[model samples]
Target: MNIFADFEDRVRKAVEAILKARETALPDLSRVAVEPPRDASHGDLATNAAMVLAKPLGVKPRELATEIAARLARDPDVATPEVAGPGFINLRLEPGFWTGHLAAILKAGGDYGRGRRTGHKVNVEYVSANPTGPMHVGHCRGAVVGDTIANIMAFAGDTVTREYYINDAGEQVNVLARSAFLRYREALGETIGEIPAGLYPGEYLTPVGEALKAEFSDRLLAMDEAEWLPHVRDRAIDAMMAMIRDDLKLLGIEHEEFFSERTLHADEGGKIAEAIEDLRGKGYIYQGTLPPPKGQAPEDWEDREQTLLRSTEVGDDQDRPLVKSDGRYTYFAADVAYFREKFERGFEEMVYILGADHGGYVKRLEAVAKAVSGGAAQIDVVLCQLVKLFRDGEPVRMSKRSGDFVTLAEVVEEVGRDPVRFMMLFRKSDAPLDFDFQKVTEQSKDNPVFYVQYAHARSAAIFRQAAEVGVRLPDFPTLDASVLAGLSDEGELALIRKLAEFPRLVKAAAEAKEPHRLAFYLYDLASAFHSQYNRGKDFPALRFVNSENGMITQARLALVRAVAVVLETGLGLIGADAPEEMR
Candidate 1:
């Protein structure tokens, strides 16, 4: 049970008493939201309920807090409630209530920390990187966030599908084709010179070239660019996509779909046409001149009327063009069709995980989705900022030209997938991240990945030690929740409080679309675990494995297992492995 929720019920009762006594007028209770104080010394739970209602009811905040506290003291669960610093109600949970939290922890286990599911259907689209190249560090952050979001959505009871949009029929693919053709020539036993400046220069393309040689070695030699280009392009794309899939597997990230952009325009006319037709029926599309982007407009800019969506009618900064001057659909046009397809597929909501460079696109995309769906579908587009690499405190060089930038595979190989995933999410998504190759690989407590993993390991170690003490630790590890009713140590109570907040924390972070929140929470919980473990070294009685008392050992071990479950569940949500032991 959520202690914060229980206290909220108490506060509501106190307010009802105040209203019944005619001491205060009915205040709007909508503003009532209880939260744990940032500083633990500020008390177990803090609320601004008195301050929120005081002015409306014509009373001072501290006075109102004192009144609320006096009435709330009647609650059996609360030892005392006091007014502190201008109206904050510092709730002190009763000893029995705090001690009983151990039972809650034992009862919850892995399911303890999971949030309630909303049953809302959503589509989480991410890592839509081009299939023309290997998965690199640039794609890592968004992929992790998106994958975690899908898992989080599942935990929250929403029907979720992980999707990857493949840019198969784009200008970039044409370039990839030409680059692969050079490899194809080399594969066909031709002594080709240095690869062209505009083409891909990676040795990874060697296989794509070899495949072409195997497939159409003789026929392509006789044909010129016109006949061979299309065949070469299609074959090369399929090869590159295979490489991308392999690279993603290294990081344990997978997608439920690999939707082709070509399918949007092939066979049955085009999805762009369908989307535009739907928009036209709703009167959103119109022939109008778009304002040139701020700062610097293109030199070739011409102020000619063109079909545009009235994006400003929603919340976009300016109206955007759906078509370029060359009478071709823009990428924005394609995105509109993609989003429309998502809604047509029956998603109640959708999330787009994009790189930070796409931050400016959030508003326009959200606006269009709302406009197109007639306010039915909601899309949240999150932009992940850049990750700057460091090695021994120096910046690692990154080059887009030579493919010298770090790949996600390289990072996962250098440091395991758990560290990479956890470190990538250690900060807010929009915030820039500094990933140090040296720091992550280091085996030290400063490394949160190792520290957190060590806590889990220590918990397991405690179970082992207890088992050696002649205590009958269950083989399958089932604890009776009722037996944990007498746990009263500060460390045990603090851990219980932290463990009991998992479900609430999960729901908050999931609702906020802030996966970093999970990372932060894990760090705090790990710190708590570490502190408690270290305390056992100083105070023998406080140790998890108490050989002198079998019942105490069982109950304490139960609490330790509860901590491990929460840690495992949280790490699992973010695609990080909870090591049974850390090397």
Candidate 2:
């Protein structure tokens, strides 16, 4: 149902046919693209094919344009092919052509905008939240972005693996273990006062402490630090991960794999050790002294010999340390092993959705992917900026339970899940977002999620109203395609044109790795639908329901249904519900 794609194919064939007729060798035609003209008055579609192929064919663009235009004018679907502006081909499609595109939409239904199989296995790792506590508002953006990307890539026919890398092997989890132990002691009648500095102070872990007390009682109290730490740490991480999963569930996000950083050290044959050895074999591993990091005086920094990876050779800003002076693998080293594991499992395309704070980790991890896979795999990192929550115009109060940041559970419970998911995606991931509590909840057109949802609900309401008035929809297969062709009103044509852009929009968003583009497209489509609906208020004949003429009403209902189909598909891709009724 991609009208633009169909036109591009036709244009390519037309040019190739002309080349064959003239006995000229065809050059690469990949850059020859057909897109909608900027001004609707210009035409339905435009192509730069003549300009791109002219030099290769040894002719002026206008000469080739005349030949291509003549060939395309003969197409049954194309009403007129005119040469416009220095060899650009402007095509005006017959009204019947749009009806056929609409029929394609009905035939495909929810599968309307999906792409053909690309045969690429993609690993999308996001929300690698430390298994320290429940996910906070800060983690929500990356979670939604990553999950939406996985969904979009899958829609584009890529085998997508949604992954979460649990940071359970780090010092943060050790702090979590100690924090849980305090709660454990508190459960056993020891009054542990205000949480000490350098430890997690949230009250959420009080339950984790109570659970530990219920499971082991005083048995763990008798063990030495080294003996009890691992047990408590493992239990704490498991509980935190469970809490995090529950929070993610509230937003409809579920990862296919919860990869453990601890596994890199524990996996048979030591994956971290093997990864380092593999790099060393390639001469990428070396003992080196790094220049003191920027902004620090040389006297203030300690120069130490360390195991470093030749990350600069693979496009990193500088060589990165693989192992610290104390012999523990740096965080980057474990990331390398994890990437290698994914690459070995047959995924060459890796996408990481990280927060803005982790911007520095981008190039190093990309370098790791290239080095570990021997240039066979590459990583794309999307950095999500901060989200500021507002109630009307003022900032929302911080959660007392979360101590500093608001918890994802609180936001979901306060606003419900749909707003949280949709509003999070309402803006690009790299831009800072201000999510207003009152505005998103408002039923007016100011709220994008509400507007899109209402467009869907209105489409359903049209059917219900039509059925109430004893007007049943004609069977799609039995209906005359000419019924839809009668829709020649400016508003009707505008909506159909927007609907025709869905497949192209989906492919563009998926290829650009920007799920927010889909969200914006849905908003635009909703705006067009709303505008058309409003137009009927002033011009009664433009209304979707007409008792005097059931044929015209049925055709308009067909258009409404198509709008719902595309809206539902787009919302589903971004993990939001397309409600039949908005309460």
Candidate 3:
């Protein structure tokens, strides 16, 4: 199905065989590569080995190229391999080569560019929002990015696990418990005055408190603070987590694991403590006096000796504290334990999708995961920058019941999952994005989600249009490989060229671990199809529906069908829908 890879393999072996047959010492072939020409005039593929080996061989690049091209002429897949521009081998494929790609596309259909699964297990963690509130707009980018990355990794052969880490055991949960306590009092028809400063003021929690009031009522009020705090915190945390899960599901994101921070240390009589102690045993932790912070230090900064990690040795700005002065483990301590648990679960590759504010934490956490896994596990943190919402070229007002925040459910309801996903991936993971609420639903090229979907719909429309004209489109039901040989138009050949580049594209994208490339590829493929579609308007004979000539119609229909297949395949990779009808 991957003809480019197949041809590249053939050419590689032929070159090596030709070299050995010439009785020349074998040069290292590791750096050699096969890639398409940026300009089509440069031929189908271009390689640089001849140019690279020219200086070492003490011969002009053209002379060496002539020698290599002479040897490559005998290969069946390559019709001609010409050396141009200082020994660049521009291989022009046979006439059947471009046309024959339709067979592979029809054979593979929706699975055309799907790569082999790596079989290596990986855990991807994202949207580990505090279990004290619903997911807001900030979660949308990470949710879509993480979900798409999981899909891409899975498609590329890795065993991917989507995980949602719930930080339900922290101080935030206790604060939420106290915040819910006030709402509980209010639900009992008792005025608790204005919601105090430093407490959650969002009205969304009113129902949570109302639910708690119905469940426990006067019982919690009568109980001691110690007894009531845990009950309230646990109930409130579960409610918030339920809201987060529902929001994610609305965005079409599903995680395999909902890991709890509270579960780690509670699993074995304080496992977090055990992990820290183990690190202490390994000389990774130490009590040291740290200097005052630089670059806008905290206002409450105090220089004192406390528990610290040897993070400086692992390439951090400085050693960070693992425990506070009150003998409580700092956030870094829990982080170390979290990754330790990730490794304990037998995952060697861990990826975390976090907001851009965590840029400072990336190096330290990567160093920690590497240290704790004993260099056995590696962590990749993909930081998603902020998403600025727009409407009519102006920032839209967002309300999450708080004055400023917008929930994930709001965006999902506003623009469904496809636009949300495609918009998020339309930019690099590290770049800030402008998401226009109004434009996403538009039917023009301004919206890539709509444009790509329209291309697939247009292809399907061609079939229906052909049928209406009594032009019976071929069903790819025959083995007449000779029928494909009829295609020769420049635009037709251009579409074939894009179709043939798919396998190499997938491999390159996988090797780079960047799913945004897949999005760009879909756009380029759609552009080619649109270009060809417009060209057919000027040249009536180039139209795919040739009722008079069945073979030409079949050949062109086969080509567009191949376009749809590749579109669906690429769209599926980035978690976007390939709709057959735009409306």
Name the best candidate (by lDDT): 2
Off by over 4 Å in 2: 55-63, 267-269, 297-302, 397-402
* Residue range with the least summed lDDT across 10 consecutive positions in model 2: 294-303
Q: What are the per-model numbers of colliding residue pairs?
A: 2, 0, 2
Task: Give the per-residue lDDT digits (tens) of candidate 1, residues 1-583.
Answer: 6667766776877887988898656778778768888887766888888989888888898988998989888878777687889898988787677656666665666676555567788899998888777888888899888888888778866888999898997878888888888888788778888877888877778898888888886688788888888998888788878877887787688888888999887754378878877887888888878666668885434488767877888788877777656666767888889888889889989999999998878998988888888889888988899899888889887665576777778888988898888898888999999999878877787787888888888888877777676788742244554567657788888887788677778777777888888888888899999898889899988888888787777777777888888889988898888877766
lDDT-based ranking? 2, 1, 3
Query: Each model's TM-score, in the order given?
Result: 0.94, 0.95, 0.92
Candidate 2 differs from the real structure by a C-alpha RMSD in angstroms, to one decimal, of 2.3
Q: Measured by TM-score, how close is model 3 to the native structure?
A: 0.92
Clashing pairs in 2: none
Alpha-carbon local distance difference test for all models: 0.81, 0.87, 0.80
lDDT of each residue in 1-583, candidate 3, tens digit only: 6665675566567667766887877676665666786678878877776777767656787887787777778776678888888778888877687777777677777777777766788898988888778888877888888888888777767888999998877778888889999999899889998778777877768988899989997778898878999999988988898888898888778899999888765854277787788888878888776788878775334477778889877767778787766576777788898888888888979988889998988989977875687778878888899899887898966654343677778888988888888888888888999899889988888788888888999899988887898876666735367888899898888888888888777777655556677777788889889888987789888887777787888888888888988888888777777887877
Better of 1 and 3 by lDDT: 1
Residue 434 in model 1: shift from native, Å?
1.6
